[model samples]
Target: MPYLFTCPHCQTRTEVEDEFSGQSGECVVCGRGITLPDFAPGASRPRNQAPGGSAGRRKRPAAWIAAAVVLLLIVGAGLIAIARVGGSAAQRVRQGRERMASIRNLEKIAAALNAYAADHGAYPAPAITDRRGKPLLSWRVLILPYLGEDELYDQFNLSAAWDSDKNQMQMYQTPAVFRHPNSQGWGSETAYHLVIGTGTLFPSTGPLGPKQVADGATKTLLVVEGRGASAWTEPIDIDAGATGGLINAASGVGLGGITDGGVCVVTVDGRGHFLSEATPSMTVNALITPRGGEPLPDDVLD
Candidate 1:
């Protein structure tokens, strides 16, 4: 006994044996799907048989109609699953590449800062302050031109406070160089942190001491990281007192794993290194204060 079937996806008529009913196969025309119900062995033919007696052949049309429906369902489900998986994979790859690009740009910014320092005496001071001695702007605003952000820097009103509620500042729109790509840290606004007066070698504004002479230029850390919620220009603290400057990641020293140059440090030698928590806690602390550290390992250079 043979049956005829149609593919739902392609609307192609197909034929299958009645004995093979309930069996599954791909449709030839649409190549979509197929299955047929099995017939009992020695099944009797219909009573109103014609002279040629082709009951099995007559049943083929109905069988094909059912097969078509099942095929379409399976094909649709498969397509949906593939699309979903592909979309997720593509997103992950894109994020990874973006993070890497941010990191590279930061490296370049670090180099530019070093060059600025070599020409000038100290790290650029926070933007000039108001008569009340309040800092009017961030230090980054001053170094914009040197970092190839000349156009952005020139647009800012040097005399105004960075957080001024006055006219909207364009500098805010330009991405700051300090924020790391991987840092999806909290706060809507965050940027790189400069450790001013934290370096022991880079002593506070005071007469140069022997310690400052030895480590100030070479041993002090120039930059670290902080949360976006924090004032990006403010030095980060290890403890509530903020007396401890160096936060180590391994020792969980300040705010846990923020020391040990855990804030990325770029030395005068133009080398960049991730300070380890394993490094001496005292060494990390000494490095942050003005005029207090030992020489860092040579390898920690850029």
Candidate 2:
């Protein structure tokens, strides 16, 4: 059973359980402090009571209606909050998966490089050049067959420059291994690149054999993720002179942009590692050099 009550401050009506009769609580409608009437529902009115019974009944109905509206509002707001939080958590999970996929792509590329080295006694040159020494195709194109993309490799016109009309047509068929999982749009551009220079594995003049890498294979960086995307067949790559020593991706230092604030790198030994943005530039430079013989910090991999 419930008892009807009225908030004197705002004339707001409310219905309370019989147990709450004579107790005080704040009015749900007007937020005014109120004391419930000391009476139960359906009780006989006192002979001295002067109000119309119909008026009291109408007020009780109105109070219950207002409470229902407030409950709905609170429940709606709670549901919306849960939905927003769930959406954010799902987005984070997606980003994490993309990051791992990108890392796996680099690992596969590293394995291909090692396979190529085993057969040729040295890694592929950073780029293939014509008689005049102008670059024609990237090492990425050269390794297509090893990546199980033999059909794509056969479609390429290796004799022409990468941007040549015939070669350009193949851009639309970029391999999954060369494209970043989180790349903005579809294109033949690649996120992976070789850090070519005098002391690196891929020198300006030619590729270096494992024996030539005075630094241990595991200590030498063979390739890195670059900042800007390049055509998979393009001969361009990061020049150590132009990029300095920065290794973190998206730092505008020849590494691709990954939200994780780290860069994925493949060493000559076919191992992939993520280097933090906080890693010292000097330390990165030392790793890039195949034979600089610089001592690596014990925590370089940390």
Candidate 3:
């Protein structure tokens, strides 16, 4: 049965399930010690209980120690507060926050790209390569100045390959703006990427400007969010001909999105949108090409 439970310290009331009866833990609201009362729905409140509880509840930690579970509430920076009520609820809260965070990262990256284009007349080239046309540095390295990491950018040897001994340590200095909130222990890896191919905004031939996008700036795909093994400095991008904008493609390609059960994309107009897993392959492909002349699905924006 569900019954109203109140935290002794803060007097915050919640209608909780009977499964948590007799279980003790930190208060979900005020982060204080608490224990759930074991009772049925119609149980009468004792004399000093909530709604008319005594004033000394906050000062009485010893009264709760026998019942309060040994749990601590750690407030993560910029993350949503967790609920211990159920496993699925906690997971949902965590995933939603991660999706929002990844989208914000893409927005910052988009702003940097636009700033670069405003100054250079086009987005940075897909890669900085050697004289023999071997790829070295990613365009991510090219936009460091715009992302406010000028010192970290200067540390890189532009002429050397990303893995070259001269540029090795710089690979681990990925800026916070380029890193997804959930990426940990990956060591300077980034989930953000550019889609590159003949028909995409980043073509192997050259970087395309606003005037080159036939479908209009608001409709062109500029950057995508995906998990990859590549370091931020690696000159790797999703190949449109290879991946085709499908979320969580089957080939084990790194473009498998960062958010759980979701994909985030930033258009050439510097706006970010979250696409659900139910989004059709055709809808994703339509958004990938700037010159496809395909009309976007009406509900994609919804």
TM-scores vs. true structure, each candidate = 0.53, 0.72, 0.70
**201-235 per-residue lDDT for model 3 (tens digits):** 88778888766778767767788887687888999
Number of clashes in model 1?
32
- Comparing candidate 1 with candidate 2, which one achieves the higher TM-score? 2
Off by over 4 Å in 3: 1-85
Judging by lDDT against the true structure, name the best candidate: 2
The CA lDDT at 193 in model 3 is 94
Candidate 1 regions with alpha-carbon error over 4 angstroms = 1-106, 183-188, 198-213, 216-218, 230-263, 293-302
Worst 10 residues of 3 by lDDT: 69-78
Ranking by TM-score: 2, 3, 1
lDDT of 2 by residue, 1-302 (tens): 44445568877444444444455556665666666666734453433343333333423433544453365457768988999999999988997787778778888898888888888998899888898988999999889888999998898888899999888888779889998888878888788888888778887677887778887878888877887757888888888876667655445766545536678887887777778767778888888888898998665754
lDDT of 2: 0.75
lDDT of 1 at 49: 29
**Candidate 1 structure quality by residue, lDDT tens digits, 1-302:** 44445556776544444544566666644565666545554443344222233355433444454454456466767888998998988877875564445445546666776666656755565345678866676666666678787877777776776666541455345455655555465432443555444343333342123223456555655545444444433223223235354354333334223222234555444444555545566666655554444556755433
Model 2 weakest 10-residue run by lDDT: 50-59
Error of 3 at 129 (Å): 1.1
